[model samples]
Target: MTNTIIEFKNVTKQYDNDSPVLDHVSFEIERGKFYTLLGPSGCGKTTILRLIAGFTEASVGDIYFDGKKMNDVPANKRQVNTVFQDYALFPHLNVFENVAFGLRIKKLKESVIKQKVQEALTFVNLAGYENREIREMSGGQRQRVAIARAIVNEPEVILLDEPLSALDLKLRTEMQYELRELQRRLGITFIFVTHDQEEALAMSDEIFVLNRGKIQQSGTPIDIYDEPINRFVADFIGESNIVEGRMIEDYLVEFVGGRFECVDQGLNPNEAVEIVIRPEDLEITTKERGKLKVKVDSQLFRGVHYEISCYDEDQNEWLVHSTKKANVGDEIGLYFDPEAIHVMRFGESEADFDRRLEAYDHGDAHEQ
Candidate 1:
């Protein structure tokens, strides 16, 4: 059986005088995988990291690392490391000293520390920059140094707190790939916290979506994207057109725009559902060839494709991705395959939605 390296069981935390910041969050992170705590700002992603790092104590319940409870263990005592958002390098120290700082504290032999520090630097592709001053290195380089610093200590787990949030877009994207590759090479469990949906989707083996101090959903990137549990997740993760509808049967769904046949099951008849269709899932056609006619309200160029906003007879706004041209006032057809329709359960709260989605996956596997 695989080991669950990190476990949060009914964990809750709150400020001394404020409302709770984390409310009974529970999840298991497997060893040697990349897990992301993804959500909007102040949604408790960072709070979970703090709880794991022992920066903050749990208000209730328990946290565990490799079957060992982490109640009173100080941050430094835990076999864990953190790479903060700001890199947090010592301005007065060079790259070599900063990366070697952790090892020196452990009082390791100079030769072993030197070899490990060099290996960590090379793992981050900063092999020859050991002498570079922290003030002289670029943002990406400094970020890597921070990572090298953490990994050089050979911690069982590394917790990254929005470590790429400060870099330029291009650099951040590059570092995302590098960090993923490094994690795989080292075979260390990485628990990353970030608010960027694309970053989480691109890097995480599994993602935990949080909102308002609760876990909304947890799954692989494809699982979360193709089968979001609620309207909030459907809207937050990517560009999606949320169409309100009613399910008539296991294979049929009806909306104000039109009725379509789908392949999804386990839904009740005549129950209201929210249909989530990604913008890219939609195809544009002339009014004569489409299932539904919509008047284009605006079009914005997004480099490779045009993002067109439109409206149907019910005055409900819908967005379509198209390479074809349709002026602001022109009417066109929006076509989508039935497979693109994802139904959100009616009257499902965030936590309820998460549980239902997990159960659905479990049942699907059992049936298979």
Candidate 2:
């Protein structure tokens, strides 16, 4: 049976008579899955989390938790907890008291509260740090304390608002894995909010790409990365080479740079479109034998691979993820299999990217 723990039905949020922050947003979050609200900084991803936590009310529409309406409910009355980006741990409380703060409010017995707090700490891998002060712990440890505090109450849902944003890259990556594992083990719904596409893609069981206060696309990481609904999602989620193109037919497209066959089909004949190619999807070679020829503009050596930039005859710049070395001004043949091409229709506004992506489906979508 499908267990949808949270539902947003035509939810919208507006601060004033101006444009709404969340506009008619609707989706279902299944229980025991890790979902991410991903987008740029002002995209209203955090607003969704806040609304779910009852921190704010929807300007329109309704929010449901376990089939119960939450319109009049307050944050404290909801069976949910939030872990903020700042950790929000008390300066005076030690690790034990911090984790046990919620239980203490209920006036629970000393023995029971101690046991629950110890279990929560142990669950978060802070096993013998009951006496450790909050300031003494590392950033990651402190973040874990935040998690422990939230989970100690055993809330029906845990909402994390960029919990790892303040940590270093290495720590952030580590926490991504840990967060996924913890969510799976706990078998609870985890609604996370982040602007980092890599972080969202790495950890989410399902990802909702939000932009301009609305959901642009929602799917697994593989789906969102491999098949972005529109240009905004393609551009936001990762590095993509975008270009203008026209759909020639079901299996073919023509563009300024070149003509190629793609997996995506277009709804309109001769539709003005955009195509996206991931850096890794492109193959670069010094040999002069490929469909598209390019001049290497620059190369960056990352630890695992080199990110090389190239420009084709149309003066359109593209990026390729390669291990091969090449210098600026080096003419090279960039090879890509037919399957790499993706097509998108030209959008009038930024939100059009999301609207287009939401309309996009697999089985050969194209970006020119």
Best by TM-score: 1
Global lDDT scores for all candidate models: 0.88, 0.87
Candidate 1 residues lying further than 4 Å off, grouped into runs, are 349-368
Off by over 4 Å in 2: 347-368
How close is each model in CA RMSD to the real structure? 2.1, 2.5
lDDT of 1 at 263: 66
lDDT of 2 at 130: 94
Whose lDDT is greatest here?
A: 1
Q: How far is 362's C-alpha from truth in model 1 (Å)? A: 6.4
lDDT of 2 by residue, 295-347 (tens): 88988999899999888889999898988888999888887877888777775
Q: In candidate 1, what are the lDDT values of residues 229-298, reduced to their tens digit? A: 7788888898898878989889799987578988677778988888888989888888888777889999
